[model samples]
Each structure stands twice: as C-alpha cells, then as structure tokens.
Target: MRVKRYIVNALPEAVSMIRTDLGKDAVILETKEIKVGGFMGMFRKKRMEVIAAVESGASKQGGTELPQRKPSPEVNAVVEQILQTAQRSSAAAAVMEPPAQPDPPVSDKRMEREQFIINEIRDLREYMVKLSRQQSDLHALSEPMLALKERLQEQELDSEWIDKLIEALSESEKSADRVYDRVELWGEAKHMLEEWLQPYNNAEISRDARVVHFVGPTGVGKTTTIAKLAAEQTIKRGRNVGFITSDTYRIAAVDQLRTYANILNVPLEVVFSPMDLPKAYKGLSDRDLILMDTAGRNFRSELHVSEVISLLQSNEPNETVLVLSLTGKTADMAIIAERFSKYGIQKVLFTKLDETTVYGAIMNLILKYGLHPTYLASGQNVPDDIERFKAGKYVELLLGDAEHE
Candidate 1:
C-alpha cells in the first residue's frame, strides 16, 4: 500500500491532490481542518490536511519494484506541532485566564461542526460501551437462560410462552440482590400462596330453603355452572334442588338448563321479570336448595349490566359467584371483576381452563384484586370438569406443569 498526505487551502483541493498523487486508488484515512499561517497567522485561511493510502493490487504500475520510501519532515513537524498545541491548550485551559480580545466567538457553522464531531464521538463511545455490556450480560445470562429453556421444554410449556416467562424471570433476577437467594424466596412465596389458595376450593354454598343466584356476563358458564351445582346437590348430596331460570331472555339457555334439571329430576321454573324471581323462589321454597340462573348479559353494556345487577340485588342470593372466563384478557377479567364487585361477587369462579393454554393471566387477575377463586371448571361436563379451586394445581399449570394432584 502507498500512503501519502496532502495539505491544501480547501477540502476539494486536498481530495484532488490525493487523487492525483495516488491515481484513483486513494483511500482517505483521516481529515482535519487547519488554520493556515498567513501574515503572522492573523489572516487565517481554512485548510484541509488529508492522509490517504492506496492498495497495491489497484495500483496502475503493476509489479514494478519501487524505491525505498522516506518520511517527510514537513508532515512529521506538522503532527508534532499539533500534539504540542493540544498539550499547551490543555495546560492553558487549566489556568483559566480571560482572553484580552475574547478572540471573536466561534462562527455558528464552526460551532455546529465541532458539536457534530463531539456528538459523533459521544455516540460512538456509548455504542461501544453498550456493546461491551451486552456481551457481558449475554455471557452471564447464558447458563440461566439455557437452564430455563431446558426446564420449560421438559415441563412441556409451549415455546410461544417461553419468552413471557423468561422476561418475568429476567426482571426478577435483576431486582434481586442475589439471584439464587431470590429464587428461594420466590419459591417460598409461591408455596405459601398455593397453601393459601387451598381452603378456597369448597365454595359450595349450603342453603336450606334459601334462594341462591348465579349471575355474570355472557358465555361465562353461568347457565352450565348453575346446572352443574344443581345436579351435584340434587344427585350426589341428595339435597332437594330446584332450578329457576330468569334466562327467559334466551329460550335456548332456558331449554338447556331445563334439560339438565329434568335429568336431575328437579323442578325447573322459568321467570321473565324481577317480580318473577321472588315468585319462582317461592314456588321452589318447598325444596331444600333453590339455584337461580340469570341470563348472561354483556358486562360492557352499562345499561344491560345495571339490569342484571338490579336483578341480582333484588334476589339477594346468599352467596353470589362471579363467573369469569379464564380465556379472556387480563384487563377484561379485571373490568368484569370490578363491575361485578358491586353486585357483591363474594367469590370468583374461573371457567374454560381446558380451552386456554395460558394461565398466567389467571394468576395476574387473582393477584391483582386478591380474588379468591371459588371453583374452576375445565370442560363442558356438568359434574366432572368442575373441580374445587386448588392454588397448587393452578401454580403448577401456570408453570407449565398441569399434572398436579
């Protein structure tokens, strides 16, 4: 490679000089603006000093032997002078003396150029530091990430959910003073929470000639759950269970519940108005348990929700189970919980677990509101899919291990 330097009054001139000296094979290595000495350095001119190197293969004079190169004293002197000027400027700036003439404030253009260069240098330095930090972080995280990945795979967690779990783990790891210690702490907390969730399972309300109402939004398994509980009390427990449906809003829903009631050999009453709720309960008062099923109204519609809540309030069921679907978004679950919270939703019944692959949203809902889940329904089976709430089972399911007793 051939290296050379050019000093000219303008950048264009410097570029032209390098191009001419090294033909078209020149590669600019560095460029700097200088104040040329003219009239005792008072009348200064902008100059460009450029160093360029040319590749050997690209040289026009192919395999020709060249004479030994000699360094230019002028170039060496210029570099030395630049270094000395930098050192002197550093020393002078340290002393901090006021300038006599103030040297005329730098032009906006020059200031902008200098600022751009400074900004570029700062950005480059920051980028380099970030790259180094990321490298170290990746190296440190490799073992944990790998361990987590292996654990998740063995637990049969879907790959799509791995990123979310990893993110949660990473956040926990960062906030922890000691990662291993934090893991132990988190494990203990999880176990305690699981233990706390155990007693909440048998949410079965015992009523002797008392009206029990199940009310919530659409498709939350309100009708089916009413049938399930009604069947369990009537068939398994041998309680005189009577089913009442104000779900005359949907004839199909009424028919569905009536079918279940028929199978259980229980009396079924279909009511239309608020007045009908009391009348229906009175008709079934001869029975030991009266399970009233309400139509699934859209919770988002305030007017409809008010209507449902008004019905629930009028009936005043001993215990109201706010049926919430587990498959819904966490925000939607929260809104539903809040909406029904007014209706005195004492316990939460999460349904449709079999339909959803993710259960973290369930944990988020329960933890966010400190909700106590009354029961969990996994499938469409009346008395089979439904299981009492168990926090350990839920935590295991959430951690990608669904098979827990």
Candidate 2:
C-alpha cells in the first residue's frame, strides 16, 4: 500500500492532485481542514489536508489488479470523520456554485465510496456507543449515584433495571447541573420507582372474586397467608368467609388453616384431590367469600405446576394467588414466577418479608412476568402482619429508609 498527504486551498483541488498522484484505484482515507501560515497567530489560511492511499501491487496501466484490503478499525474511524467534513464542504459548495453532473464512471465510483463509508460509519458508531455507555456506567457515576446503585444492587435488583434507574438519575443531575445529597437522592429514587411501578399498583386482591385460591411451593407459608387474608375478610370487613384446604400431603398445613377457621368462625372443608372440588364448593355455597388453600409442591416441575393449576380450577368467580417467601433466592423465585405464569396465574402474594432485606424480587417479578402483587405478609400475627402491596410503602422499604417515614 502507498499513502500520500496533500494540502490545498480546498477539497476539490486536493482530490485532483490525489487522482494524478495515486491513479484510479486510489481512495481518500481521511480529510481535514487546518489553519496554515499564521503570522504571530494573528491570521492563518485554511487548507484541506487530504490523506489518500492505493494498492502497491495494482497496475496503473489497468492490466493487473491486487485484491482490496479491508480497512482497520482506526482507518474506518478516520474515514468516517473525513466523510463528515466532505459532506459539509459539498453542502457549502452546492449553495455557492451551480451543480454539474459527473461522468458515468466518476459518479459510480463516488457512489461506491460513499456507500462504503456510510456502512463503516454505522458499524463503528454502534460499537463506540455501546462501549462508551458501558464505560460511563462503570466510571462516570458520581458518589451519590454510585451510592444509590450499590443500595439497589444490594436489594437484588436486575442489572438491566439498575442501569435504567441510574441513567435516568444521571440525566436529571446533568440537566440540573448539581449533585444531590443523600436525602434528595432517596427522594428521587422513591419517586422514580413508584412512578415505574404505578401501572401495576393493584395491591388488593379482587373483592369481586367470591373464591380466592392460594398456591405455592412447600414451606412458603401458603396456609398462613390464607389465614391472614381470611382474618382480613372476617374481622375487618365482617364478610362471610369460608376455608377449604387440599393440603392433606402436609397434615400441619391443614391444622394451621383449621385453627384460623375455628377462630374466625368460618366454615372449613378439606379435600384430598381436585375430584372433591365440587362437593367442597357446595358445602361453602352459602359463604360470600371463600379462601381456598392448595398443597404446596416442587414448583420447578411443570407437572406440579399443572397439578396445582388443576386444583385451582373453579367455575365460580375466583382468583388464584401464588404465595412466595422473601427468604427464597431471586433466581429461584424468577423460575417459580415463570412456571406459574405459564399456567396463567397472574396474581402473587409475598410472605415472610420480615426475613429478607432484598425487595428487588418484587419489582423483578412484577415487571418481568407482569405478576400482580396483591399482598405482603411479614409475620405470623394474623391480619395485623399482612397488608396490601402499596407501591409507595414498598419503595420506602426498598430504599431502606424507615426513618424517613
């Protein structure tokens, strides 16, 4: 390869010089306008600096031709910059002088060069943008932004969402041209999170559904969650509530719910399988609200999910709430959410919130699987420990500022 640099009054003169020196196979690799011949830095003449290259083995006599080598990334970047300068120069020239069409070969060659430059520019732009964004995320964050990021990461948030939140904060700070203090940062985080989750802020279970079923994996407190919700209906609302349990696999589960049923004075019915659903429904037919409990099993298996969905089947107006414990791993919780989502169980209830500090799984499940979070159970204290999933309150807990309340 042969490369030469030329300086002239403008790009057109430089192009003519390059063609005479480097032949038809020559390519303009770079172009820039620079100031030259300054007198005490007072005045200078603008000259177009052009860098052109040609294949060393190609025949100038149009006999033998060497293969054109692909440009390196550095070469591509240089060419892209050159193309921008060329476009600006051409635009200025178009306004200053009348246009003249080039010969067929010259026009075709120019088009090929432009098309090549555009393709290289697009690829280079995309790669550079992603690289810059990653670098910015890694290093450009201020102390306050980093603090908030660390806080959310500790709460087990997905990296994808964390970036979105941090980027929004970055934009806000950039616009205002000021760094926020801890209190201000907390306030911004709460506001943004609540806004993002506001669309899914259906905290209460549907009162319209006469029968509500609770399903979950073993030891996730499905029975206890049913008890808590039942207490709400019985004690708070004074509504006629009934309990039906198919948790015969665990005798303790049935007993736990039965104890709550006896205390609430709500009728209790136990069924071993889905076949007994009709008879149990008939027994609780007089009840205005029926809270049904399904046996918890390995949720990872599609077979178990199918079985649980079968038990949840009812012709009456009903809703199924999938209970999950906060102590569970985020990945495991996502898997359960995925499995249950396949069965069309959209509503969810989280249990044992007092046991874990990471509330990210709530946002993860809600946003990712479109799960409607109905309630959160923090303790064993019947209805007092359970509450509807308020977005504002959850954001407060998520941001770790019970003191701000």
Candidate 3:
C-alpha cells in the first residue's frame, strides 16, 4: 500500500482531496495534528496530517472516472518532476562549499524557515514514496487525532506533544522512547496498586473464618477464583475450607462450584434466598474459611444492584471482595467499582489479565478504588492462573525487564 501523508489545515478538506485526487478507493490510515513554523505560527496554527493509501494501479472500478477531478496524471507528473529537480539541486549544493554567508539576522531567520518547511515537505515526500512502493492495504496509517488537536488547542501544541501523541497511537507500529521503564515511576505505580489491593488479603480467613463474599459484574471468574483460594487454603495450608455459592441463579454456576467442592472433598451449600444464608453458614460453620460466592450483578442496572445489595447486607458479609476484569476499559471499570463500593467491598480481585496488552486500566482501577487486590486471575486454569497479588511483581510486569536495566 502506498502511504501518502498530506498536511492540510482541515480533516474534511484532506479527505476531500484524497477522494477527488486519489479517488474514493483511497483508505485513510492515520490522522494527526502537527505544528509547522515556529513560535506563534507553530503554537497558534494547527495542521492535520492525513496518512492515506491507495492502490497505484487501481482504475475507477465499475468503469469511468469521477466528474470534475482536478490534478490529473499530467499535473501530478509535472509536480513530481519539479520535486525531483529540487532534490537533485539540493544534493549538488550539499557537496559544494558554502558561499559567503548572508547577513546575520536575515541568514538565521531564513535558514530556520527553510529548514522547517523542508522538514515538513520531506516528511510528506517520504510518505508519498512509501505509498508508491507498497501495496495500498499494507500502508494503513489512520490515527485518532481529534482528541490530540483539542489538547493542542488547550495545552502545549508544540512539536513535542504532537510527536508524543503520535507515538502513543502508533505504539504497536513504531518504537519510541521506552517510557514504560523508569524503575522509580514503576515503583510508585506498584505502591498505588498495592494500596488499592491491600484489602483483598484475608489474613483473618483462619481466625474468625466468617463468610467472605465475592461480588462483581458477570464473567469475572469469581467462582473459579473462589475455588483457587479454597484449594490453596485446603491443600497448601491445610486450613479447613468450605464453599457456599449464592449463585443459584445459574445452574451451571452451582454445578461448577459443586465440581470444585467435590474435588476438594469440601461441603458446598447453595443459597438461593437470604434465609438460606444461616443454613449455608451452619453447614460449614466449623471450617477455617467460608468462601461465599455471590450472584453476579450488572451495576448499570439499578434493579440488579439493589437485589445483590439486599443479599449481601442481609447478614453483612464479614469481608466483601469485588471481582473485576482488567481487560475492561478504564472508565467502565472505574464506574463499576464506584457503583459497587456501596456493597462495602474490602478487597478486589482483577481477572482477565491475559486478555489485556496494556496496564493503564489496571492503574486507573487501583488509583480510583484504593482497594488492594488479593489475586490476579490470568487464565481459565483452575488454581493455576490465580496468584497472590504482589505489588513488586505487578510493577515488574508493567514496566517490563528492559525498563529496570
């Protein structure tokens, strides 16, 4: 794909150009806002970079070209020839000794302006070259720059921010500064996650051995996580463990828990109503740890939240664990955690770490909730993917190994 970069003052106008010049067959790859010129012009004026691609040999499909399309092949050919002439002239000048320099102020200013315009033009020229060499489909470059443009208007619109935003959007495609390193920064992030997740550690699981409730949105691995914890306490620690599931709403949920209980040789109680809470506790009152699995609730739905709240508050679980998926968007996770905060969540369990490539949302959740996580459920492997949440480990994983060195 041929990737052509155009610096226009507007997006629609650039899009129009691509549609008209390159035809409707052109595909937008990336869009960004960059500053041109210096001081006032660079900060105050903004230009959009439209990175588009089109098949070089593609004809107007289904026949005839669009009406009134300007800058035909002849015009493009002439422009190309002129650019080629300019490049040859510039190269020849590079090898020759400089003439007596121009007057001080005029020379400096002219040089700056010339360099700026040349850099911009060079970037576009390189993009055009790439567009000519590659298959159109291989040159996808579209990026979300509207948000960056707004930020540029409000904050620093200098070349630095423009480049940083571009780098972030094209992270998978390009290698910029290894920002994820900075061990000190990773340490701070680790501390923040630990502080938020600190509550999930059930130090009193063997003491009071009271009902520990797990509540969260659907499919957060609460049942499987409970099993992992139970197995750890039973087989590893030799702590007497019992499981009680209030997730009688789904037959599979009960059977799943039952299967785990059967493997552990521990008693399992299914509580469908608030009255069944006492019975569930009585069935496993002698165990060292009572893991109560609650029904999954949709925090967005008032009815579902109310129902789950009623169940949890009826007996007031000694410890409430909020199970959240780290794969969810930061905004959505924050809102859900806040909504469920009313349930008196003492800790959090972040699941689906294997599904997410970035840890930004995890940072958001920890920063927002201030509930330390007890475990990170990475996969569906029972007792295998579940691991104790360690602040240092998380920091290391987030920043990666290269960051520390």
Top candidate on TM-score is: 2
Runs of candidate 3 exceeding 4 Å displacement = 1-209, 313-317, 401-405
Candidate with maximal lDDT: 2
Who is ahead in TM-score, 1 or 2? 2
Q: Candidate 1 overall Cα lDDT vs. reference?
A: 0.63
**Candidate 3 residue-wise lDDT, 242-295, digit = tens:** 888889776599999999999989899888887777777777778877888888
Across 253-333, the per-residue lDDT of candidate 2 in tens digits comes to 778887888887889999988899999999998999999888889988989998888888789998888899999999999
Question: What is the clash count of model 2?
Answer: 0
Residue 25 of model 3 has an lDDT of 59
Off by over 4 Å in 2: 1-133, 402-405
Error of 3 at 376 (Å): 1.0
The stretch of ten residues in a row with the least summed lDDT in candidate 1 is 62-71
Question: What are the lDDT scores of the predictions, listed in order?
Answer: 0.63, 0.79, 0.62
Q: What lDDT does model 3 reach?
A: 0.62
